[model samples]
Each structure stands twice: as C-alpha cells, then as structure tokens.
Target chain A: MSSAPVHAPASNDVIATIRDKALWIRRRSFQMVYEAQLGHPGGDFSAADILATLFFGVLRYDPERPDDPGRDRFVMSKGHCTGAFYSVLAAAGFFSESELSTYMQPLSRLNGHPNRNYLAGVETNTGPLGHGLPVATGIAIAGQIDAAGFRTFVLTGDGELQEGSNWEAALTAGHRRLENLTLIIDRNRLQQGARTEETASLDPLDDKWRAFGWQVEVVDGHDHAQLLEVLSASPRGRGRPLCVIANTFKGKGVSFMHDNVAWHHGVPNKEQYEQAMAELV
Target chain B: MSAAVSVESGFFDCRDSFASTIEALAAADERIVTVVSDSVGSSKLNGFRSKFPERMVNVGIAEQTLVAVGAGLANGGKVPFVSAASCFITGRALEQVKADIVYTNVNVKLIGQSSGVAYGELGPTHHSIEDMAWLRLLNNLTLIVPADPWQTEHAIRAAAAIDGPVFVRVSRMPVPALEHAGAFEVGKAEVLFEGDDAAIIANGTMVHRALAAAKSLAGEGIRARVVNMATVNPLDEAAILSAARTGAIVTVEEHSVRGGLGGAVAEVVTAHDPVPMRIMGFPGFLPTGSAEWLMEHFGLTAAAIADAVRQTISRKR
Candidate 1:
C-alpha cells in the first residue's frame, strides 16, 4: 500500500523532514535485521540518510507509477544495505512498511540484496560489487540515445569500488560524457571483514574518480541539507558523469555500533536491540 | 523477410550471417544496439557499425563492462547485442554474465564469436573450449551454438525475439550450411538424418561431420541417426530420449567431452534411457595447430566419428 506523497515537503522544513525520515529508516532497518536475524545493519545505517534524502527529497519518482518511462532511475549497487533501501522504499509509498517484518523470511521479496524483478522501484538486481555503475552508465547512454531527459543514479559502497568492473565502466562513462548519470559512493570506511583502508585502501578516492574524468564531489552524507543540495544539482561535467562521495558513519545513530567493525553484519541481541532503539529515539 | 541470398556452397562463415542479420534487425529496431569489446573486425560487425554508428558501442578491451553495460542498457529498455570473442567474454567477464545478465534476467544478447578452435594456432589462451561448460551452470540463460550460416542467422533472430538473457555462438570457421526442415526455435533440436542402429548427436561445427559419419555408417550397413542440437540449455529431452531408443549414441563436439554436448546428452540419457555412449571431443589440451589440423588431431573427422559409432553400436550388442 502507498504510504505518502513522495514530493518534497515545504522547502524550509525539507531538511527536518528528511532527518526524521532517516531516523525512522534506521529504526525500521534495525527491526528488520533484528527480526530476520540476518542483514548488514552497519551498512544499512551508513546509507540511511542518503537513501532517505534521495527517496523523500530529491528523486523524481511516483510511487503510483513506478514504471513511468520518463522517471529517474536508481540502482542500489551496495546491495548488502538492502534493509535501508527497503525501508526508504516503504516510506516512499512503494509498499507497506509492515512488510519489513518479513525481511529475510522464506520466499520474501525483501531479500539480502535488491532485486528489480521482485520490487517495483529497484532498477536492477545487484549483490556482487562493481556491477551497478556499469549498468548505470548503460542506462544513461540509453537515455542519451532516446533523448530521454530522465537521469540515472547508482549507489555503490566505497569498498565495492575495489571490483575492477567499476573502473571499466567509469572510463567509458567519462569517455561518453554521460551527463545524465550520477554515481554515489557510500563512503563508510568499514567493510564486512575490516576497515576499507585495511582491506584495500580507496583513499584519494575522489582523485581516482577525477582522473577517470568524473566530476567528483565530497559531501557530508548525514547532512540532509547537503545531500538534498548536492543530489538535486544538474550534471556538473560538460560531458562527463558525476561522482558524489558521501562520507558517512557505519551503524550511525547507534552509540555502540557506530564505526565498530564488529557490527558489519552483526545482529544485536535483545539488550543491544533495546539500546539501539533507545539511541534512535 | 526474403532479402535472403542463399549460399549453398563449400564453406560460409557463420559470422557473416550473424553480422548481416544483426544489421538488418538493428535497421528495423532502434532498441537493438551493438556493444563490442574491441572486436568489431573479428566479430564481422563493421558493416553494422558503418550503418548504425550511433548504436555501435565499443567498450575497448574490457569484457566485464561489455556485459555490465549491456545489462544496464537492457534495464533502460534497450535490447543490447554484445559481440565479443568467446574466450575473453566468457572467461574474463564471467561474473558479469552471471550476476548482471543472467541473475537479473535482462533482455541482453551475448554473441560469442570465434568460438571453439576457430582462432586456430592462437593456442589454448584463446580457445573457448570451456564456454559451454562454464555458461551451462548459470541459471536463466539460454546457450546456442549455430552450426552454419543459415542456422546462425535464424539463431540470431530467435535470440533477438526472446525477451531474456541469451548466448549465441558463431565461428570464424566456415562450413557448408545444412538444409533443415523447420524454423530454428530455442531449445529445439532437428533430426538431420534418421536411422535405427545408432544416433550421432552433435552441435556447432561437429553437426556436419556427424552427418557425413552417418553416411559412412550407412555405407557399411550400420545406419546412424544424426541430430543437430543447436540449443544446449533447456535441451530437447524428447528428441534425446527418442535417440536413446536406438540403444547406442555417439556424441561429438569441438569442446571438451566433460561438459559440452556430450555431457548434456549423457546426463539426460543415463537418467531416462541408459545406453552405451561414446563422447568424442578434445580429451585435453593440444599443441598449437591449424583448425583443420587440430580437428583431425583430436579425432573430430567423419571417419573417426564413424569408427566411434561402430564401437558404440558393437558395445550395445
């Protein structure tokens, strides 16, 4: 069932509305992971604000007409963070928020990763890293061919960029001058096993993207004002795609979980869950 | 549909049919965009490029992006036809094929050119002998190896018509186009020649050889049936079972016997109709040689196939 209109709230109150929505997303993500006993809560929290802002304030999508040809396209490349993705979609009126309870249940569409066929708003199914950007580049190219003014956005985990496929697509996107595409990197330092730097450093990540011909932007991911401003802007490069590095904290809003490597995909126990909910409140 | 110039000659490159058919289809449907991995010359897609420059995209030596981008294009409502060499397209970007194309179930066409030993003497590094085995394991993907130009053109058209992920293989090596009765349909096999003594099941370049072997077997009073299995996945189990009734089978392919046509036939036969079978293919890696030399070296000739059929039939008795 539809939740609410996806249009941005009054301009002055947009940030506050998105901030409250981000908190709700975090709570819903925690409950989903807690009930399912499975999911990457850390990643979900890290991307909560970015997802909430995109769904609520920036993205040009109609929940009632999910398949509208001229609507904006979004690909959640950081598929492990599907809890946050699903929660935001639920809040955006794609489906009922109550479905979150069925998060990792048998045969549930809310899988460990986002699947386009299973959900209305998911642009493509992605679990493996480095896939979404290339697909987004292709989508942007299609828009260019059809002269379709719709923009394409893809969210990728910082660590996921380590996959060579992302660079391959980046090189092509830059060469094609895909002005209609925007790639958002969820720059939460932590990965599944360790910090991203410890696993495989992506430091100077913006420089790397710039070298590949992308118009790079580094933004405070949790700031709703900053997110809405950066995301709503038109393509910056004359002929190149845009890359927005969204610096965020893992397990955000949860005191014990934030930036803690142990919380990567860790499901909190009963006491930990209550404490997380308390912190979110 | 009758712009067709039939070639009933000595040998015809299947890539010719592939390029011509794709160009014609692209002319009709703007959704049919061609993406290549620096393989326009080898894939014989230059004409299509010249005609539809806007639709031709070259990812330049990157097979991973070739498929990933194709998946994305499909996501945006365009039917992408990815043309690349089989060895790199299937080996280098295998995960993209699995995750982006197959797992997502997008409408992308993967045309693997110069498959098998078509890149002759280029050594094992370029041989796509493992393509069938590797691609077969992935779900929601259709695998087709067109034996000649007629079949190749029809297969390309069939793949374009289908709505999901499809892999069509074409070879640089030319072979006489075989005349078959019905139109080419996905997951369907055609009986080229019929006999009761034994069945010679083959695909790709080996179909012609299998037909010649059946003729040789008939000369010796040992009649052999010949079946051309163009589609490997969603195999025509009914035709396979019917061939099994012969009590003997000789499977031939230009791939490793472990998981190509032979492996598929064996799996089906043993489960429903167990019979004496001989799988003929490159048992292992071979020294660099010409395509003809390598085919003969691996016992892929009609004479060798006939000998194997004789052995298989003898074992059945």
Candidate 2:
C-alpha cells in the first residue's frame, strides 16, 4: 500500500500509488471506526484522502527518525477524526499496522485524540476544536526564525472554525506573512448533527481566509492528484500564508454513508458494517 | 498586640525584574522569545522588545493567540516566554493554557503579571485570583509565584532551564526584598523562621506577611514557623506534613480561599494528620479600592494572619 516517493511529484507513478494508498486509508479507517464503536466516522471518511495524500505523497520525514528537527510537521487540528489520522500513520509505517486493533482500548497508544507525546508522527495533542492551527502557526513561525526549511501543515474541520481561536491564529499567521504555513479546511458540508450552512453559515469561506491575508485554494478533497498538487506546491504567496479549502463528502467512498450526517459518530451495526466494507472493497 | 515593624526604604516591582531577566536570557540564548499581548509597557517587556525586536512577538491584545503562539514557538525549538496580565491571559485563554501549553507538555514559560489583587482598583474583572486554582488541576504545568523581584528573576531563569510548560505569576505591587537562606528550588518550600507552635505557609507577597505574622506571634509566646512555598503545584508535602504533625497550621495566599494553596495544603493535611487549620485568603470578591485596601478588606494582614495562628493553636489537639 506504500505510495511512490512524494518528493518526485512529476512522475505519474506517484499519483497512481497515492490513489491506491487513499483507498487503503479509507478501508482501514472504516475498519478502525467499526471496532472502536466510539469514533467520528463522518469526519474520518471525509478527511481520509487529505490525510493519506499528506502522509504518503507530500510530507517529508523518516519513520525511523520521528524526532528529527528537520522533518515537516502536520497537525490534525480536527482531532475527532483519529480513526483516519491513525490509519494513515500506520499505513506510513509509523507503527505496526496490526496495532490498529487496539484503537480506543484502555492504555492504547492511540487515544480518541492524537497525542504527540504518545505517538511519533503526531505533532501535538488535539481534541478540543480550534487548537491545531494556532500551534501549527507557532511551529511555522519557529521554522521561519530558525531558517528551518521544513513546512507546517494543519487540517481543521470546517465546523471547528466556529471556535474563535482559529481566527485569532489566522489573523496572526496572515499578519506575520508565515510563508511556511499551510492550513487545510475539510469542507465536508456535514457536521455532528446538521449541515454546516444550516447550523452556522460559512458560505464564501475561501473569501474569508483571503480577507485574513492568506492565499486561498479550493480543491476536491477526495482527489489525491489535486491534494498532492496543491499541498506540494511551494507556498506561492510571498509573505503570506496558504489556506486550501478541501471540499469533501462526509461519508465518502461508502454508498449508504456518503453525505449522511447520521454517520457523524454513529457506529455501524453488523449488517451496516458488512455493507460498508463491501462497498469500500 | 499592635507592633509597629518599620518597613524598608527600597522596593522593587516583580514585573520590571521579569522584563529585564527576559532580555538577559534572550541575549544569552537565541531560543528565548518574549510573546505578549501589547502589554509591553504594563508588563515592562519593552526592554526585551527594544533589544531583540524580532524576538518580541506582540500578538496585540489577543490572549488566546498569545498562548498558542508561545506553544508553537516551543514546538519550533524556541523557548517562548509568554507575558500577559494574569486575568486576561489565564482567564481569557484558559483552554489554550490547558490544551496548547500544559496538556501537550510543551516547553513554554507563561508569565502571568499583576496576579491576585494587583489590579484591585479596576475591580473583579481584572482580578487574577482564580489562576492558581484553574491551573493547578492541569498536569505537567509548573506554577511558581515569586515573593519579590529577586525571586521573580530567579524563577524566570529556573523556568527557562526546565524542559516543559511553566506558569510564573508575578505581582505588579512593589514588595520588599526578603532574606532567603536556602537556594531556590522549583517544588521545595524555603523555611525562613523555625517554630514548634504552628506553621504559617504562604507564597508570593503573602510570604513576607507570613514572616511578619510569625514575628508578631513571637511577642505572645506563640513560636510560629514561616515557610515560603513558592511552587504551588508540587505542594511541599514534606513541609506541609511536618507542619500538620505540630497539630496546628495556617495557610496564606493572595488568591481565593477555596481551591488554592490553602486547598492544596488542606488536602494533604486532612488526609495525613488532620491538624487544626485556618486558611487565610479572599473569601470572595471585594469592594473596589486600592490593593492595600483590598488586602485589609479581605483580612489579609500580618496581624490577621497572626490571629488565625493563635486560634488554630487554641484548637490544636
């Protein structure tokens, strides 16, 4: 399931391998959520492609040297989607893939949220919404100060943006013109109980980020080619941060679950799990 | 007993010492950066700003960003010293302090300025009395309240030397320099006066008042011991248990009576020894006035503390 080297993006093999890796991530994420019974499958399925592409086809780091200062940082700010986040990390050889069975078990290295202290690839602990961006901005600013060539990437749930702390970090990041920072919004219209627009309108979302002095990029979140192309691109806006609006479906890849808000955190029964697995396979 | 103990001529503001120490630390180590919320003048961090302008990140009145930025800087291999008004920084961005700084175990120094009733005239909105209670619950965060400017300077240095998150609370009110015999340690309390009758455990500006209380208690043949418990999180259990063994104890703090230093000491004392104790602090909000007036209103004075010690001794088993 390993993708071709991400640093060589010009090759078509990289795109093909990434597509395969994205499927593996989606299938594995579904399995993890089914076992955990207490997880966010909607957001997990929605952000699967973005997470998969970033780990396999974009981020630069050695699994052996998890603490290497030179490595790029990716903070999963939308922490509820630990199912997909941990699945991709295992796919990338961060830990034994067999350990995925231990998800949500007591004392498991994989908690409900990503804990950087426990997991190697996790950059910071994120469970409460609106935390990851500010910390990512801090890491980016540090990279700038140290002249460290590594870039910082943070993925936030579109609904999580309702929390004010994200905007606070956004204002600071844009004002500082943090060129090494990239913010990705999982624009899966569905939230916990309702559509993001029905709950709290975030229409013209791209314009909102642009107003905060960031270069906005709208892309198909589930498209690996698009995610790799946009993420791997050199931060174009000089003295400005980059924000990618990744439009995706809540329960992507599975027929019954796709765009269904009920699956936000609803665990599948045996029949539903089998049907979902059949569709994913 | 109304004893007139003459006060000293020289006084120093802990904030000034904090700002100067930040500058010195930043000069010595490039990793040190000062993050503030445009309180350079109030926080006295303009010295650090003037010297290393790039290192001074003023997020401009945003407390949440101030804390997150500090956490980020620490993640980036920089030792960020976040300085802000204790109330705004701790109260406004408590979640950030809890999640970004403490829970993650990042190496960031949070300098909570003008803690306690230092902003008494501004009323309860600016009061940072609840900071200790709010922060002590979170794990991996070190809480240190320096008694004076010298202790503030040393605390900042000690916080920098550590590898995880720390909150160093400093008062805006000028305090007289104290004579501490032992070296400064993060969690260990310093015993200034030794007495067998009862112990007065305090921190920050209250430490000096506790010492004064012990002095006045001596007049009544109540030999009270005084302990400067600077570190609140890792409560000096050895000192507290020892004090509890004496059958009488009084805890003082410039904070709320409940869920603070007194609460911390009482937790250990009640479980270990169950001594007769009187905790001295603000029972609740006070009427707006000067810091001195507020202290008196809350019965937070040397004489009042001495009185509490006598009462505890009277009930001692």
Candidate 3:
C-alpha cells in the first residue's frame, strides 16, 4: 500500500483547513443538489464538515490506491448525505471536481447513496439506516484479524440510530473490545420527520452509548478545533469502542434550512439555492 | 447403473455429524470459530463450546447480531461458522447476511441448523423452508444443503477449507447416512446412481428419497438417474444438462417449490436443454404436523418422488 505524502500540520492548522474545506464542500454540495433537482440537502449540509475532516485529515487513505490493505476504512452509514460525501471525495482527489455535476444524472456513478461498486472511497453500499455500523465493525474486525493498525470509522445520523441493528452492532463492538472502531453520530436534532426529540427523544443519548459500553465523547460538530481534538483523542477506556456524539444543526451553514425538518429531502429552488450558496460564501 | 444400493437403515441427525466434524476441525485449526444465537444445545454445539469457549460466541437470542458478529469475527481473521436456527438465521438477519456476509464476500460460513421442517411441531415460525430461496438470491454466496450425516460432516469440513461466503443447511431430523466415504467437492454434484431413462435431482434430506425413488422406479421397469446436488448456486450445469438429455427430469427438495434446489435445477434444464420437468416440494403453507408426517403430506417421501418421476417420464414418452 503506497502511503500518501503526510504533511504533519499543527492540529489547529489542520482544523482550520478542514473548516475552510467544509464550507467549500457545503457550497459545492448545495449547487449539485440544486442542479440535480433531487437530494437530501439538509443532512448533506449538516454532515459536510465531519465528512470533510475525515476525508481530508483524519482518514489515512490514498485515493490512487483505494483498496490498499492498510488504509483506514470509512463508511458513510447515513447514506442520504451523498451530496456532502461526493463533495468531500472530490476535494480529497478521489475523483475530479467536475464530476460533481454528474451527480443524480442519468448513468451517474453518484447515486442517492454511496455504492462501493461505482465509487472509489466508499467501503460499502449503504442506504438503509443502521447498516453502516455493522459493516464497519466487520472491517474493524478484519483489521484485527490481519493485525493491521488501520481503524474503521462510520458516520451515522442521530435519527438513523433509531434502527435496532445499530444498537446490536454497538453491543457487539463493545463486547469484542474493538478499540480500532469509531462511530460518529451526526447528532443534528432534526430528522426526516419532525425534531428527533419530538419524534423519539434520544436525549440522554450519550448515556445510552456509555451504557452500551462505549467510550463516549461529545463535541461541537461545526467547530473544527473541537472536532479535531475529540476525533484524534485515543480511546480512553481500553477494550471499549469509541462513540463521538457530534452536536450539530440539521442544515448547518444554510440559514433558512438550518434545524428545519422540511429540508430533510427537499430540493432547493433557484432562489433558495442562490441564498444558501451566498451564505456559504 | 443398478438401483441405489440400499443397506440396513439407521437413523442419525445431521446436526450431530455437523457438531462432531466442527469440533474436530476446531481442534486442528485455531482459526475456526462458532457464533451461536443462544442455540448451544439446540444447534448441538455444546461440545464445540466446551472445547473452544473463547471461539464460541453465544450472542444470547440475537439472531441478526449473531450473524453480524460472525461477520465481524470473520473480518477479524477468524473462520466463523454462525450456528443458529435456520428460521432465524436466514429470516431474521437476512439483510445482515446480504450486506455484512454475502455482498461483502466475507469468508463466513452460515450454518442454518434444523433447516426445513426440522423444527416440526414448533409451528411455521420455526420452520426454515424459505432459507434456500432467501439465501439463493444473494450474490457471492455458495449455498449447500447436505443430504445425510456423512455429507453434512464433509460439507462442514470443506467449507472451513474454502475461503468465501457459504451457507450450509444442516438437518436436525434424523437421516441415514447417504454418501459413502469420499472426497467432498464444494460445487460438484454426486451422481449417486445413473440411468438414461429419466433423472431425479435432489439435495439435503431429499437426496435419500431420490435414491429410494430410483429403487422404486427400477421395480416399475424404469431406470432413473439420481443426482445428489449438494451445491445449489454454482450448480453442476454439466450434470444437469446431461440429465436434461435424458428427456425428462424430476427435482425434489425439502423446501418450497419456489427458488429452492428444485427451482434451480429446473432453471438450468429449462434454459438450455428444455426438458420435461416436474418440481416436487411443499407447494404452499403446510398445516401443523410432525416433521415426518409433513414430509409425507408434501409428497417428499420415496414413493411419491418415484411416482412423480414416473409421471413426468410418461409425459415425455
């Protein structure tokens, strides 16, 4: 496996770069979604920063050698956020930035969700909620089996966690003491429906993860410095998995759509798209 | 070839053979592991658990988690055989089986114990007659349904040696050993008895029935070729095409007529050779009964299978 040129920047500097990239990703993602006339823009905006940080800074992956055995595996379990994912991958040099225009078009590799068969950086084809964590657990276990130091990280929605399979995987990850596995819940309160609290209160969500035997950490999902500090921190309680509860707004960086459930799968019209892009600028 | 050589019968459950073979394999290979969904005693994996406690993961009634965890374990460099009730293993954790195991092409062996109506009076919920159909739809999965105890043991050992996703349905119902001591090929079908008149292709608990059906057909002055098709996915197209050349074929299975071994055989025969075929199995929902009674009711017995072969052959003539 060929290693990417590693420039060891100060942690703060890396965070700042990630923040700038996240803004760019949000703007690009919104444009793509608007042009496509179909996509979950709300979740994409909510998760753009986290996706940017992981693809650019946190994950040790070479786009040229996507299937490298030693590469850290990342699964976008909340697959509805494909716009953000595609934007981040383009920025990471997995594919050309021009390819973003092809998203959701006829015969486009960029589908509604991440598909490993078509896309480069995607580890698994995830769309249905609660699937990514289990698949990530498998990759983590595979890493352990080969005694490879590569870690597996999965990004799931706070609402997507409602699926029982995620909890099932959580228990197994904890029981197996898969220290190499990390789960980052994009805890943007709004879901496809109303607010998560109104739909099904996942308040005390951190306790729920801790009770399941995970090393729990909460971070301001939009704050690049805080995100980097929490993400790079090693698993504190040995033999337990790590779960980072990332508090975020549903439609971060977009003023009208932020924390709004209607934007969950809403396609922004020309005016809204212009306004969202202007805000990002 | 003469009619299938019938010997004095003795009843033995294939699960016992599976347990013993798994135990032996685990003793030889440290990488071999078993993950059960709270079915240690039911799956007859008590000995495997006792010998390899660390390797035996009892996930305590969570079927989906059992499969997911097994996939996890397999990912971690362990050859994991996920042991659970076939009904739950295939039905409950189907998506996990698709996503984590088969679609990902992980080297996980899913052992569906007590497949078919093996859980007999426990009701339809416990019956795993749909396992074959459900698993067959997935890609990169090798589906096997062993005929008897000897075949079951061989399948277990062979699966461990192969490095890919496999689902082997082990019958809890007692069956006399079918295959004699021989090498177990993963995808090759065993031509237990051969005749050009007509063909009877069967798998799992139904293989013995097909053999017996051949004998009864012989008594009726008919020579029926009997093929024990253990591997369902990478089907023996050569054998099936040869059987198709026999003018007529009869497929028998312990599952539904839809998408089981019978369906697979018919698919091959119809597409290439277009032979006169009769698919015999549980056609629809079965009423509650003992396993043996259900088999008889569904015309899965030797006499009924022979009758179906005779009928199909007569149609061809």
Candidate 4:
C-alpha cells in the first residue's frame, strides 16, 4: 500500500481509496492487537480514519526518502495506539506489512510504544503523555524560522491532553503563531479505565484551544471526507496554529464495541476476534 | 573572538564562555539555534538573542517545552543549544530529556546553566547537586562538566560537533581559565598534574581546586595527580584505571557525594582495580550560605581536598 498522491478536496476516487485504506487499517490493526494480546485496540479503531486520511490523503513524502527534510511530519502522541500507527506507516510504505505480526514480540521493532530509532516514519519516541505536542511545536517553530514549507501535525488522545505539558506546548504554539502546526485530538471520550470526562473533564476543549490562540476546527473524526478536507487545506497566512478536535467513538467499527470504554485495551478473545473481524467488513 | 571572555579579572564565569562560544557557532552555521525557558539573561545569551533574534526561541519558563523544542529543532535540520537552569532542565523536564532527546538519540545540546551549588544562597531547592547523579545513570546521553572558560568553550564546540544527546553543565560561579593541553575531547580525562601517591579526580568548579590541592600536597612531599574528568556519563574508564594505579584516589565535585563524579570513579576502580578512595562533595542538602561559604563548609576547598587525599593515602596500604 504505497502512498497515493494527495489531492485537495479529494476526488471521489481518492476518498474511496482512503476509505478502503481506513477499513484495511481497522482490520489489520485489530488483528495485530488480537495476536499481541497486550495492546490498545479500542484507541486504534477510533483513530483509524484520522490516521488513514493523514497518511494516504494529506501528508507529502516519498517512502524512499524518509528524511527528505522537506517532508511533513506526523507525530503520533497517542503512542499506545501503535496498532493503528504502525499499520498506517506500513500502508504508506515505511516498512513491510508482514512485520506487523512481530508486534510486542521480544526484539521486535514494534514495541508497545513507538520508537523513532527503531522504525522509520516514527518522528519521535512517545509513550509518556503530553510529550508529542511540545516536540511538534518545536518542529513547527523550526519550519517557521527557516520559512520551510513542511508542516507538523501531531495526533493525541483526548485523555492525553490532561497532561500539563500539552497545555505548556499549546501556549507556545499559539504565542508563536505557528500556522504550519496542526493538532488533531482523537476525542474518543474514553480513556484507560473510564470516560475522559469521568477521569478529568475536558468538555470545553475547542474553546480552550481558541482561548490559547489557536484556530479551532471540530470535525467528525470517523468521516474520511471531513478529515481530508480540513487537513489538506493550505496553512498559508493562518496567523495561528490549527486545532482539530476530531469527535470519534472509542470502538468505532464493530457494533459490539462501539462507544465501549471496556475495550480501551481489552484484547479480543478467539470468539470475539472472529466476530469483530466479520463485523469490520 | 577565540580567546576566553573577560579573562582580565583572572576569574571567569563558565556561562560567559558558553554564551560567546554558542553565538560564534551560530554565526557560522545557519543551522545552529538557541532555545531557552526565559533564561536569556541568566545564561548570558542576550548577546546571542540580539545577534540572531529570529533564531533564539524563548518558551516562557517552560522547561519541558524548552527541551522538546530542542529535539524538534534538531529533527528540522537545526543544531539546538537548549539553555536553562540545571535543576529545572534536569529535574523538572527529566522525562522529556529521557524520551524526546536521549531515548530518541536526537542531536540536541542541553546547556545546564548555574549547575551544582552555583545558586548558593537560594538553598537546596535551587541547587542542582542531584543532576549528575540522575543524568549519569542514563545511557546515550553525554554529560560534560567543563572546568573553566577554555574547557567550557571547547565543550560547547565539541557538543555541537557530535550528533547525539549531550548535556553541558555550566556554572555562574567565577574561576580562572586553567591551562588545558589541547582541544576538549568527550570521554577523555585531562591530567593536569602528575604523581603516583594518589590521584585527585574533579570537574566543573572543583577541578581548579583539585589542582590547588595537588599544589599544597606537594609541599608536604605528598604528590597527588590531578585529573579533570569532564564527561561524566562515558566515564573515561582508561584514565580512571590509570589514576587507580596510584593505590589511592580522591574524587571531588560540586554535586552530592552519591551518584556523581566520585560514584562514577568508584564504579570503574572497583570493577577494574580496587583502591582506597575519598569522595569529596556535599553530604546531601547543606546549610544556606554563599557559594564560597558552601564550598568551604562542605570540604570542597583546597585545604579540605588535600586532607581527604592524605586520609585516602593513609588507607592505601
């Protein structure tokens, strides 16, 4: 699954291809989590569309030249969702799809957390919450200083935003007027053990971003067309950074798991895996 | 431009050397940038910020962001010298340092300003005595504690030349630029004085004092070799092994007695060749006083180091 050339306001063919890729991501990522038995499958399913659209329909890079310097960066801040992240990167030709079977195996490249050193297309190491945004802001600031065309996008779990470092980075990105930076919050509303609001309320999240000096865009996270349209827009002259709060369900594709918090990191049993795979089609 | 800054006073602050060197490096290389947590004034980087206003990134007293930005800048083809007070940079954003830079193996230079007890009167909360202990245990991060202006400049340049994580500890305390043989090399100790009776291994504000200790010990017919072990993480095992040949050794630093220069040297000596040793530094937290008072009170002075050397030699055999 090599990267398809991105088209702004993507054509019907492109949207169909992205949907196909997103469905493939759901199937493959869940398969990985099921085999690993120690993975975060719920968040992976929730972020599949956003991750798929970004890689296949929005980002610009050559799979051959991972460090082309001008390539846009997609930082996976919600690191535990490696099931989706590594799947998308593989689809975009970062690594062999066969390697996905090695997930969580000893000495495997696919660790529980994404390691940039271990894998290409992984911009940085992230497992601890609140780290991706600040680092992405720095990368955006660097692009701004050099007048470089490369944009930086970071994806975070809605619950991960509860970490103070993200707010600290949010303040810097807004103050610097980093138009090249975009923060995509996967608002699944479900965290590890409970709902995000139940854990530590973040209801007025869009207004919070606006107050911090960012341009906010609320979108249906699972809608491939909405994600591509909003993410593919030119960042020129935006003045401030963009924050896209992507409203999504924790377990999006399978009916039994949709909006289910219990599936946050629940490994599918043999019977459940068969049912989820059948429903994913 | 190459000479040590403000050498007229015979005492120089390493931070001055740090500022001048970084500014020079940035002037030549467009990729060189500075990131600070509102530490331009304290880091003596006003000159850097003025010269390259667009390149200096002040993240507004946010250490975690300051460090993460440095890693990001490195990813964007820039060599970032992230400057901040050592305590905050190391203690506050330690996880950021570990994950973003060290774990990622990013080419970022972290300038830990006013390290050790340089914040003397501000008390232990401000003191960065635990930085070395915390940082040394982390592999893949280079830790350099330059002794004076000359070493500081060399350390900064050497840090920039490398392509991995580095933490350069700079002090605000004043000290003369001592005579170093040549350019600074990471993980190599510079032997300032030679003797076989015992070896004095020290770095940062304590190196010159160790040399002075050697000078005093000379009059008593006790020749103590002085080694300035700057890069703490790599540990210069060969130099330490050679120093251990003296049968006795004294490791001094401006850090806590545990998990620092002394602790590093002890680890090497015990593994390769066991030797009698004395570790000279603050015991833990110290009573409030000026930097000089704290040094004297905690046996970091020449007289005190010499006494430690004598005691270790007595236990040698």
Best by DockQ: 4
Pairs that clash in candidate 1? A177-A239
Q: Provide the global lDDT of candidate 3 against the true structure.
A: 0.83
Clashes of each: 1, 0, 3, 0
Q: lDDT of each prediction vs. the true structure? A: 0.88, 0.87, 0.83, 0.92
lDDT of 4 by residue, B1-317 (tens): 24556635788888888888998999899999999998999999999988999999999989999999999999999999999999999999999999999999999999999999989999998999999999998899999999998889989999999989999999988888798876688999999998999999999999999999999999989999999999997889999999999999999999999999999999988898699999999999878999889999888899999999999999986
Model 2, range B171-207, lDDT digits (tens) per residue? 9876878898767899988989999999999999898
How would you encode candidate 3's per-residue C-alpha lDDT over B208-241 as one tens digit per residue? 8899889888887899999888998778889899
What lDDT, from 0 to 1, does candidate 2 have? 0.87
lDDT of 3 by residue, A130-179 (tens): 88887677667656555677778899999898899888888878877888
Residue pair clashes in candidate 2:
none
| Candidate 3: segments with Cα more than 4 A from true spot | A1-10, A64-70, A95-98, A140-149, B1-9, B23-31, B161-163, B180-183, B272-274
Q: Write the per-residue lDDT of candidate 1 for residues B194-252, one digit (tens) a residue.
A: 89999999999999999999998898798899999999987899999999999999999
Off by over 4 Å in 1: A1-10, B1-9
Model 1 chain B is weakest, by summed lDDT over 10 consecutive residues, at B1-10
Error of 4 at B189 (Å): 0.2
**What would the TM-scores of all predictions be?**
0.96, 0.97, 0.89, 0.98
State the DockQ, from 0 to 1, for candidate 3. Answer: 0.41
Predicted structure with the largest lDDT when compared to the true one: 4
Chain A TM-scores, per candidate, are 0.95, 0.96, 0.95, 0.98
Error of 2 at B121 (Å): 1.2
lDDT of 2 at A239: 75
Q: What ranking emerges by DockQ with the best candidate at the front?
A: 4, 2, 1, 3
